[model samples]
Target chain A: MLRIILYSQWKWSRGWLLPVAVVGFAIPYFMLRVGYSGERYWDAAGLLEQVAAWGRGYPALAAAIGLLVGTSAWIHDHRGDHVYALVLPTPRWYYVLLRYTAGLVLLAPAMITVFLGALTATWFTTLPAGIYAYPIQLAARFMLATLLAYSLFFAIASGTQRAAGAVLTIVGIVVVTQLLAGIAGSDLNVLEAAFDRITIWPGPLEVFVGRWMLVDL
Target chain B: MPTMKLMLAIAFLLALPWRAMSGQAQDLAHVIDSLRERVSFWDSAAGYYDSITRADVDTVRVGGFAVITNGADLAAVEDAVNELRDRFIPIVGPDTILFQDKYFAVLGRGSHVVTEDIILAGLITDNITSQLHDAAQWYFGSETGRQFQSWLGPRVPITDSIAELPGIYEVIVLSPLTVVQRCHSGDIDACGASLALGLHQTPEEALRAWFNAADRRFLVGQLRPQWDYDLGRRADQTDGERRCIESESDADCVRILAGLYRSGMDVEAYAPGTNFHPSLPLDFATHSSLAAVALELGGDGAYSRLITSNALEPEARLEHAARASIDSVLRTWHAWVLRAAPPSVEVQPRSAWVTLFWVVVTAFLAAGSSRWR
Candidate 1:
């Protein structure tokens, strides 16, 4: 059952997933090419800045992949009003479990490609003293961050149309309240407060914060 | 042979410019013409200088600050001065005695001219307060007539945050000195050694007090370029310096450093681009953080206490001001420093576990979807 679900998910997301994985595989190489220029002596500070600039793309790529794969996991069922899922002998919870596991399985290609990409990139480049490439650490972080975003959007996408609408309505109300507060010259900012709560430490989004360096001291 | 070729190349480059000078003679004439042009330009600009001297300098006073400017934006300058006074009030106390008759002149944006007594900052800038704060440290320090340099460098106030503390943490962690690493690991004695508190030694004794033989050798290597420059300037390489660099003799390294100190190189070798005094181990931020912790523990009248206790040794003075044992104060500081360690590249275990918990929770939420009905 899990294998069938995995094959179905691959069929659905393969086109978009292939391109994203390819980009992920190419990114670390691109970072090395752009960061170092075969100078006899490397300025660690300047190299650090370049690596940091390239590192920002990982989280953004992870988010994109998560969004694509997570949505694709439920898109067919959602389009068919979940009739196929309803007709299956498996319980709805079991089906959801299968779909979630399937999505996670599909995430491996992108994760592995980036890991290999980082390894290849650092393999060719001679890093400065006290600096080392974190291919495995970077790959693990990418996988976890991808899973986080995937789970969040997956949960939302798995809901009924009305449930999704309720989520949107809540978001709309928050925006309206924030706008009203600003217009009335109040210091209240609901969006900013919500963002801080979501992005700060211990927040689910905190993983995306701070330097995601591939090569660091 | 390479050195000979390098010198020949330099000589050739220098001669290239003047090789045609005597033959053409037109080059010399052009140089004279350019110099004359520059003189005339300066002669014409003298009128502008005369106008500036003749123009009235406007004075803007706010709280304890008095700024003299060319009447461009007195209102903005007034606000900036008021803000600076607000910042300084916390660090220096409410007593306006130190601020009395201190005049600052603003000439243009981001420019500060410092005389013996007066700090003239030119124009309004985003960093006006920071620039003024830096200059005022010296002015205030001089007014207090206390030597606070034994432990802290300039005693600058530090505002700690995630973005700020990690840099200082990196310094302590990545330092070559074992004492600094131990300090980071919460060793109070190591913290004292690293901070060099209560050590009344000359700069050489101070360096020896903080660093061991291997540590001194490492420092010598790091400061090799500066030592080479100083040696080359005198055109004399001492036996100690020669042995230190060539034979990697640690004792020779220490001796050369002592000579450098006796010959006028002090804290300048350790911390360049800072107006620091001798015998301090850590950088400005790290010292400031410790001082800040002391001040916070001391609470009300802490700044006054700190200033008055300057006659005592650094650790005694800090303890006196904070009204706490040196051990407690240093332990607290060491804990704070540890907490500020740089964020890791790998995902933290807590973060990973928390993320997993959330994933499971969200997955369960997805399973309970009303669409399943």
Candidate 2:
């Protein structure tokens, strides 16, 4: 059953996986090129500025890949009304676990490709003294971020379209509330407040708010 | 070989002043250029701006004035400074640099690079000060670190540590995080004042001060709740260490105190001068303790604001909101803090081989004497 689930996930994502993995592989190389000017005397500050600017791509890439893979995991099942999985002889929880782990296993290629690319980029680059590259840390962070995004989108995919629509309506109301509050010149900033709630320490999204430095002090 | 040595001696002789001047400091212009180009303001904790405050600006101002005064081109520098002071100060907003570009247009004079640097130095400090002020207002209004500004909205200033300086750059290469750790452990003048009070402080005294300040900041910052058991433990440890000081060897006392200090036990047996803090200087063994008095009155930030005031005013408590106000405070702070501006421009680089030669010759004679004996 595990083999069957794994094969199914692979078949679903095979086309998207290779292309996105290549993009992930290219990110660190591009970041390195952008950061390190071909000068013997490079300004660490200036180089860091470029590197940091490029760092925005890491999470976005993770989210994009996570969304693609996660949605793909369930898209075929959703189209068939999940009847294919319902007929499986395994217990419900076991079948769900099989699907989930299978999806995670499929993401390994992309994660590994990104880590190796980042490592290769770090190997070739010369950072100023006192600054260092965190290839492994970055790779680990990327993995977690991708996992988080995948879990989130995958959970949303589990729900019916009406449930998704209700979530969308709640988000829209919040945005409208924030806009109206701003128009009224109230100190209320619910959007920023919500962002802070989600992105502060102990919050799941907190990890991404920190300086996304590939090479850092 | 004789002529070679003679020529070598001549070259080294001329290199002395050049070496000395190189060690003096990089020109203020380079620092300004770096500030304009690179620094993004990252305040470590709320209510505290970066460490480089009015004092650094004074050093740069005095240094810049010296360069201008001593240069053969004083008239040009003086004209630029005067133009900025009189005409530009009024219109100096966040967009003062833009105003500067416009000023150049009206006067039809080429841009004064030196004057522009001095102005940038002022702007950088102002930028830091305002961010601090905003942070303080936010924190004071709502005692939480949650309310952060959307943008850094300011240029960066040198923070808890100085920029990597030449000669001493190696000593100060620790990142801001490392400095903050040292500060949390009570090593760096966490309050941004220098530890250069010309008094010999032992490791024990330094550690003692660390424990005390950590305890103070923790208390004032309201880091731990009033009912925290750790506070009691820290106080007891301080007492035990103080009692142990009398019975044990000073070395042993330091060992005991060090443990207690690390454990964060505040010393009940502590007296005013029991162990002097690293940066806080008292009027005496018994009178006017700066750190204690300030905390008793307010919090660590207030006390810090008193001495360093990364955001607070020294004399006037001036609001550095607009460019005009920022420029005003910049002018006022310099006048009040420093002595008359010195003519301390970089000295002409001369050779240093003569000193090197003499030292070598002396070493040679000393070695020969060992054989002669």
Candidate 3:
């Protein structure tokens, strides 16, 4: 059953996996090279600016991998009307688990690539004092972010089109409510309050906040 | 056919001119020239404004004459001072009347000191002193003042007791002993007045006054019920440290005290002083005390407003802005600061190499696995 699941995931995503892996590995190495080369004459401020600008790429990579992997996971099933999956001699939960596990397994290589890239980047650079490189931590964060994106997208893809529409509608309602409150000139700091609630302590997205410093105190 | 060809040629020729005109209009050279002119104008204006604002503040700070009073009133007095050289000193005609605390101090040269003294003597006549003192006694003798006087009595004696403690000499040698002696002898109002005056005499006296003032202010500012406990603990720690010092180790005590003084001075150096004394304006130390007092009184709003209004002039604002911008740029300069791995002193190239090696190997294995399936 595991073999069948792996084969199916591979058949669906093989075209995208190679390019993404290469790009993932190259990102950290390229960033390090450019950053180090600029470090000689550039002051700490300039260097940090350049590094933060490049840091945006990590989230982008995670989201892309998630979206692509997720879309692929459902594409074949959708094309075949999901008839083959429903006919399988297993519970729907088992099928979903198998699919999720397979996608995670495939995601491991890209995660490894990020880790390698970060490690290599750290190895080559001469970090300033009071700073530490956390390649393992960076890799772990990248993995978690990727997994989160993948899981979210996978859940969306697995749902009926109506379910996806309902989720989008709820998001739209929240955004509209916030926008109206802003236009009404009420000191209704809904958006900022919502953002703080979501990004601060106890929020799922809290990990992304604070400092993303690869080398931090 | 020839007519059609001519029409097409004319249209093409007209289009060329239009495109050229648009290109010329959009030329970056013109934009750069305009930007340069605007920036130059702004830069000149900013510079002029900065200088004018600084000059205005300086003039305001030294507008009045500060008569140096070194009597009993000079004991433990804390006040801000601003200085001006003789050449730019404003002359209030000799016959002009000046009120204490109302007019700013203008320190003039010794050449005119005798003339200024004669003028000031006429202004602060005995009649005025007696009148002001009587007014103060009357007000302070009233129910409100009596209540305050009674409330103040216990606190003053406690302060005197603290000042008279044997180790007080280690902190402040002159004013504390004089103040304690004065207070112990039942000259309560005089003692209070002396302490206030001593703080204004010199920077050192001002600092000692400021230290005591800060502790008192801190205690008053704390809203928590446990603040007393916290303050007591802090006081105990300070007392313990003071008591631990051996009188025989005066040199060591001096060194330690000097270090502590330097730390306080350093903080003051970054702060702004008040405009009270003409000959010697408050130094960084005095300014820091004032800033601390402002903060203790009203929190960050008071502190920020005082510094912004009194200390941060146009020139200082520009300097601060430039510093902040540069600091921000430095913070983001390194991708190195973003590394997720715990850095070791020695670079570990092995982890990178191994990871890369395995990634390639895994990719190939994945590819091969797909082919087999």
Candidate 4:
């Protein structure tokens, strides 16, 4: 039963995993080339500036990996109305575990792409004194970011469209409330308040906020 | 005969628009003579004048034909050019005066030869210093001022609410120069000193003391013709009145069409209909003092010293402080975005090769399974 479940998940995920792996492998190398396009003397400040500018790509790569992996984890189950999954499973938690593990297993290739890309990008560039490359560290961060996104999206994907609508409505309501508060001059900075609440330490999104330097002190 | 003919032509030229001709010609001739006398001075200053002309000849042309002609003949035309040169002198002469003032302000007085060299050296040094100061002040003083104020007053409080609250003592010492230090130190004494000095001072005195530096800096940076939304609005009103008159005229359609065409292309045709020029309702010094106080309260180390030592008025100090705080916050926010990291997960030694092999195998299996499904 577990083998069958794993095989089904593998089938659904492979379509997305292939293209994502290819793109994922290329992103770091491309970023490295673009960053070092100018003169031979690599000033530390200049290199850091380039790296900082290109940092946005990391989240994007993570998000793409997450969305693809998350969506693939559920598509087949959704298509078959989850009836086979419900009938064959010894327990609901057991079935979910099987699906989760399989999805993670399938994500391995993309994670490897991230690792290889970071390694290649770091290898080609000669960093200034006091700076060191952490290709493994970067790859680890990428994987964690991908997993967080994948898990969140997977949970959402498991639910009905109505659930997504409810979530969106809540977000909209919060935004409108904050904007109106600003207009009213109430001194209640709701948007900022909410952002701080979500992005600060101990927050669910906290991990994404700190320095993600591939090379750092 | 040749000399007589030249004299006759000069007399004729002198007779027509004598006032205009004499003033212009004499000024130009004087400038030419000065240029000849101080060839080195002309060589050094010529590049600066040329740059200004290149930057603003078209805009200057609108003031009058003479302005443009004078600027173009800055290096060439005689007499009339001297008067033209005088105008440029007033603008650049301020730099010399400012240098003198800064030297006097800093060194008090020195020996005659030393003072003279100091004045010259000061001019060059002060020129760069004044430009940087002006750029910073203008950036804080313009529309960005409001944004900075908002960010400082509201956004910062919300974002970093957990940070230590500003003390009353710190609020009092808000001077232009020390604001940076006070903010950095997080000490309240500096803020107290500013508040004590600035809060009740007369507007003019305050302006003289605290706001003058920033004001001078701002004035230096402002481009000519002076952009004022109110003036733009008045121009717009006049354009509207003209359009109405045209509508009533015989060439209404043609005039309206022409006006529309001009409006579409020419920015001057459609002026701004608002009073957007930055005006300090509070005396300059008071504003400076306020900025100084605010900077101390906000803990902005980089700018506090400049703000407090500059002796800005309370209001200017406060305004500048608020602006600096906002700028600092925005910069910090930008930095945060740049520094954000991805997630982390450990991998096996052969993760790359193994993952690739598995991916290929998985693809084949998935393809076979897809057919079964």
Candidate 5:
């Protein structure tokens, strides 16, 4: 049953995942090529700055890949209104697990490519003294960040149309509140406050913040 | 006679056009000079306009200090000023006169006002409380008025909500200095040395006192821009500077560092935007955190004692104020700094477990979707 679900997920997402994987591989490699090119390799501070700029792409890529895979995991079921899923012999929770597991397994190709790219970039070059590479750590962070994003969007997408509508309605209310606050000359920014809560450390998006350097001191 | 007459006629004809061309050239030069003067006038006018606009800044006075800000940012500026007063008064005592009538600008968040003090901008703007907290440190230093250097870092409370200390924690953990390492490893005397509370010397002597030979040599490389600029300005490079960079000589490094001071070279001006202070060992936050520990130990009037102590050395002043041994004060400070250490880059086990828990919970939530039912 898991194998069948995995095959279906692969067929559905392979087109998108293939390009994502390629990009994932290219980002770290290109970062090293551009960041540490020629004389830059000797300039430690400048190299670190360049590496930091390149590092921004990882969390964004992770979030994007998560959304794409998560949405695809349930697009077929949502379109069919779950008629196909309802006929499976396994329990509903068990069937959902199969689908979730398959989607997670499918993320491996992207993760592996990023890891390999980082390894090739770091290990092949002699990093300046005091600066070190963290390929495993970067890959792990990317994986966790992806998982978090996937779970969030997956939970939302797997719900009924009414559930999706309710989520949209809540978002609309927040936007309206912000507009009212602005008109009323209130300094209270509900959206900014909410964003800070969600993005700061200990928040769900904590993994996306802070230094994401593949090579750092 | 006819040949002579013809030659004289040719000479007169050539001289006539030469006079006309010289006159035209003079007119063109006069026009260019006039245009240059107009450009200079406009340049000065632009500068005058900028100064006038800066002078027109709105001032909001609260708690013995004036907050200078552009009119647009007045509301936020007032909040920050009030925050500073509420937080600062307790540590420095209400009796101290703070910058009486002096203007201070709250610069970040697009607020531009001119003042003599350091501009609080960049990362500090992320949290207004911390921003004002830093401003209060500067103001308090001014209030204390050069009679005493407040080796006591930022005396204001680091806002409890922020996850990391704005800029200081990384230096504590990652600094290559032996004194900082020793302080981290529970050496009280080293903590005193690292904090520079004991040494009240010239900047060069303070640098020598704080960091050892290797660290000084290492710093020469780190502060390359300043060293390079200082050397570049001279007709010839100093032998010590050449030896310091090329041969990695510590003696040469020391000589060059001292020579910079003797030459009255303004290295900070040369290396713009670099916090390349030779005298200060640790950051202000680290110093303030230690002071906070002392004040906490000394109870009420600790700040008064700290401000009024006759002791020349800061460590003794701290002891006099805290009413405790310098060793005890330092030990407490070290512990506090370690406790306030920023979050590690490595993913913690607890975070990993929490992430897993969320994954499962969200998976269960998806499973319970109404469409399946």
Candidate 6:
């Protein structure tokens, strides 16, 4: 039953599996190629600032892969009104477990690809004197981020239509309020407030805010 | 006429390279002469042995590097500093160093010139001194560093500055022989320290005892800068800000610190932001006072009063915080043997193996997932 669930999830996500896996493999590898100049003057003031700026791409890629795979996990179930899921002879929680486990297992390939990519990226290159290549740490962080995003989007997609609508409404209200504040010459910036609320420490979205550095001092 | 003009132009072109080459030659010769002069001065001192100790036997707590000049061009000092830096920076991280060069004048009219006590003629700015103090801290307790045990066999252990010192010697006075021996063996900070042991002896006997490693009598007096920041003089000049005054060799600078502290100035107060340029505030006033105060308080349980007054302890005991602060100050003094010594650690590539191992383990785990479910 678990294997069947894994197979079903794989069938759904297979269309983009190759592309996402390739992207996962490429992210850290490309980051190293562009980031390190391996020169004496690499310590010039703004070099680190540039590398950190490029670091933003890692988490974004992880999040995108998570969103795509996670949303795919429940799209057919939502379309069928969860009829097939509810009618399963197994308990509802057991069914959810099977589905969650299957989705996570399907993600293993991309995670493995990232791990391999990170190892390959740092293997041949000599980083600046004090700096180190953290392939394991980087690949682990990417997997955690991917899991976090996948679980979040899965939770949203698995809910009833009304629940999805509620989240969309909240986001829409924030955008409209910010637009109105701009027109009224008021500094009541709802967009920035929402971003701060979501991205600061203790916020769920804070995980994405950390630096996804592959090579660091 | 055209042929003669061509010849003249060709001759002028050849002289241009020759002119530049001669200027380069002159600069090189001058640098060599400056080096020679220093060697000669030290060599002359070796032959003379006298038992007269100067009245001022006190040395700077952290041995100050004095660029001695006999009213000659001071530009040579810049070249010397560059030579020293080029020789050391490759061994240590740049951020871990505080290389501050101040041109202070010596005031006392002395015939012997065996010295350590130099007065900064003008006020010490919090901005630059704080930066120097921060660099001192990096030498002892920066990031996690590797312990030394390699083919090199017993490294100098510069990584942990405190660990490098012989126990008790970090705070207590040792025999003159030990201090002299340490100085002789290339300890730069040891140059002008050991007042308890060296001060009582005569300059000639003391120099012979330590093998002419350092002279505690010759004080460095810094002349104050003429530029007045408060008065807005030289504020816009490119090189005016950091130039320290040459010392005049007197009790005046120490007097100024005592005067400032006596006047109820917060000697350790946070510096004014407008007047300072560091990321954090530094106690410029206390730095001059630090050695003197610590030395005075270093005697048996004297720091207890400070600990009690500051509420660090119910009573001053030499057991913990009091001893710790003294040890810390003493560490600063020991480190002064030279201006900038790097505790170099050879770079290791342990991360590569760690990365490779993880890649294999994770790949194997993923492959086994088919059998697990």
Best-matching candidate per DockQ:
1
- lDDT per residue as tens, model 3, B1-373: 9999999999999999999998988897799899999899667545534443344222222234333322212221112222111211122122222222322212221111112122211112323332222222222222122222221221111101222222221111112233333433444333333223222344444334433332222222221112236555433233323332322333333333334444433322222232111111122222222222222333223212322333223222212322332122222211111222223322234433433343344333322221111
Give all TM-scores, in the order shown. 0.67, 0.43, 0.41, 0.41, 0.67, 0.40
Off by over 4 Å in 5: A1-8, A26-56, A76-98, A118-134, A181-217, B1-82, B97-166, B197-209, B223-237, B245-250, B262-272, B278-311, B320-325, B364-373
lDDT of 5 by residue, B26-91 (tens): 999999999999888666545543543567667677767775555435666677777766654565
State the lDDT of candidate 1 residue by residue for B90-182, as single tens digits: 645787465666777666554343445466554446565655666665454444334565345544452222235555665565554667767
Docking class of 5: acceptable
The global C-alpha lDDT for each of the candidates, from Candidate 1 onward, is 0.72, 0.45, 0.44, 0.45, 0.69, 0.46
Candidate 6 residue-wise lDDT, B1-373, digit = tens: 9999999999999999999999999999999999999988766443221211222222222222343333323344334434433333333324322333322222223232332222222112323232222322322211112211110111111223233233222112212234434543445334233322223133334333332221211110111223467967533322211221123322333333233323443322313221110110112211212222332334443322222333322112222323445445444444442223322111123323333344344333323222112
lDDT per residue as tens, model 5, A161-199: 898899899889889999999999999999988778766
In candidate 3, what are the lDDT values of residues A30-64, reduced to their tens digit?
Answer: 66556554221112333444555666787788889
TM-score of 1: 0.67
Candidate 5 has a TM-score of 0.67
- DockQ values per model: 0.41, 0.01, 0.02, 0.08, 0.29, 0.07
The candidate, 1 or 2, that scores higher on TM-score is: 1
Alpha carbon deviation, residue A49, candidate 3 (Å):
3.0
Query: Is 3 or 5 the stronger prediction by lDDT?
Result: 5
In candidate 2, stretches whose alpha carbon ends up further than 4 angstroms from where it belongs are: A39-42, B1-373
The Cα error of candidate 5 at residue B44, in Å, is 14
Q: Residue B258, candidate 3: how far off, in angstroms?
A: 26
lDDT: worst 10-residue window of model 5 chain B = B154-163
Q: lDDT per residue, candidate 2, A121-194, as tens digits?
A: 99988776556788877777677667766666665665567657877998898899999999999989989888
Give residue A70's lDDT in candidate 4 (0 to 100).
70
Model 1 DockQ, alpha carbons vs. true complex: 0.41
Comparing 5 and 6 on lDDT, the stronger one: 5
The TM-score each candidate achieves on chain A is 0.92, 0.93, 0.88, 0.86, 0.92, 0.91
